[model samples]
Target: MGDKVISERLVGTSTVHGRTLEVHRLTWRDAPGLSYDVVDGATGELLTVDESFDEVPRLDQLCELLEAQQKIGTSSPRP
Candidate 1:
């Protein structure tokens, strides 16, 4: 996939992994869950697209997921 435009309506901003990120809330009409896009603060680059969240998570939980994304990005592939 390619870069996407950031949503005009953003839920909030979060600070994680020594970098600031923009958190956006996306709701699907067909499903009963909400998805989120964690984008870089400075650049509009997408850091991660966190979905499959059955329900809206608390700030701490969101933080954990974001951190996990970072860890996955940094870690080497294992056999």
Candidate 2:
């Protein structure tokens, strides 16, 4: 099998309750893909996606997103 390529970009954001929400656009190489999780920086609460993307995402793509999020001052909540 060929190495699959995954990429992510910050698409937009939405406000929830009273927090600044960051949105990410994820793209995957093929079918039979993966899912993602969002975590709150302050309260350590995990947030689920309110909607689904047109394509299922990949693990690497999610990791890249997490990295980008960290650089932008957002991070996964403490587990």
Candidate 3:
């Protein structure tokens, strides 16, 4: 889907195979809800996140690991 870019940033970085692995979270327009991507740092590949729920300030929630984001997802999406 071709969605507008709202925000993107480096969540963290790590050393993998002697290369800098940058963890990222990219948010795109998804109509009423937003679409986010968790890409692999080293290869810039998409990581699968099996989550779907209404949450506002989604960026903050996506910034953390999957385990840490469990508690959030009942709010509303941002405009």
Candidate 4:
């Protein structure tokens, strides 16, 4: 099934592992849940797309997810 975007907006910005990231909240029409997109603030590149929450999470919880993404992203070996 395809999911329709219900709402999407930038929640806030944070510096994780020395990289600036733009955190966005996204809701879907077909899916009754919340998702977050962590984007690279400088290059406008999408770094992480997490759709793991069944309900709205506290700001701290969101931060943890974003930080985890940052760690994962930064740990990858670059050519």
Candidate 5:
């Protein structure tokens, strides 16, 4: 299934106990539904499953947090 990015946003530290979050929007044709997945990227591990759009919002929130953490880990440390 072809995946397309629909929307993305950042979850501020205030919402994540002092951590930033990166929320992504994806659309797939085969599934024909809204879903979210969290990947380690560093290890290529699938941290989470394909969550449906209607259930709970936790998946989306978690993904956002993961993305934020990844960004922080990859960027150069401030002196």
Candidate 6:
């Protein structure tokens, strides 16, 4: 079978640039590590999928990712 999802839990919520985001922790049975996803609280859109952590990431790390996501979203598109 393909990689089965082991768990997915909402860590908490964080506000970045006046927008609220839902942070989630995702683990897979076949994967050696876990990942974190940031979703927009209002629109329920997935923003970031970061698989760089082998363990539970700290809140500050999630916040940093959110900040970076916000910056990318607000940047002007190149022609």
Positional deviation of residue 60's Cα in model 6 after best superposition, in angstroms: 6.2
Local distance difference test scores for all models = 0.57, 0.46, 0.44, 0.62, 0.42, 0.65
lDDT of 6: 0.65
* Model 2: how far residue 14 lies from native, Å: 1.5
Best by TM-score: 6
Give the poorly placed runs of model 3, Cα more than 4 Å off: 31-79
RMSD of 2: 11.0
TM-score of each model, in listed order: 0.52, 0.38, 0.37, 0.57, 0.34, 0.60
Q: What's the lDDT of the predicted structure labeled candidate 5?
A: 0.42
RMSD of every candidate to native, in Å, equals 7.0, 11.0, 9.8, 5.3, 9.0, 6.0
Among all windows of 10 consecutive residues in model 2, the one with the lowest summed lDDT is 48-57
lDDT of 4 by residue, 1-79 (tens): 1277778888777776566766777788887667766566777766544343443455566467657765786322211
* All candidates in order of TM-score, best leading: 6, 4, 1, 2, 3, 5
Model 5 TM: 0.34
**Residue by residue across 14-66, what tens digits does model 5's lDDT show?**
23434432333456655555554444433444434434233224745665645
Off by over 4 Å in 5: 1-14, 37-79
* Candidate 6 local lDDT, residue 35: 74
Ranking by lDDT: 6, 4, 1, 2, 3, 5
Residues 1-79, model 3: lDDT tens digits: 3366667666565553344434544566665444444444545544334543233324334445333423653322222
Off-target runs (Cα >4 Å) in candidate 1 are 1-8, 47-57, 74-79
lDDT by residue for model 2 (1-79), tens: 1145376555544444445444444455774553344544345543433333443334444455545555665543434
The TM-score between candidate 2 and the true structure equals: 0.38
Best by lDDT: 6
RMSD of 1: 7.0
Each model's backbone clash number: 0, 0, 0, 0, 1, 0
lDDT of 1 by residue, 1-79 (tens): 2233333247787776676767666665555445665666776656555343444456686577667877786322211
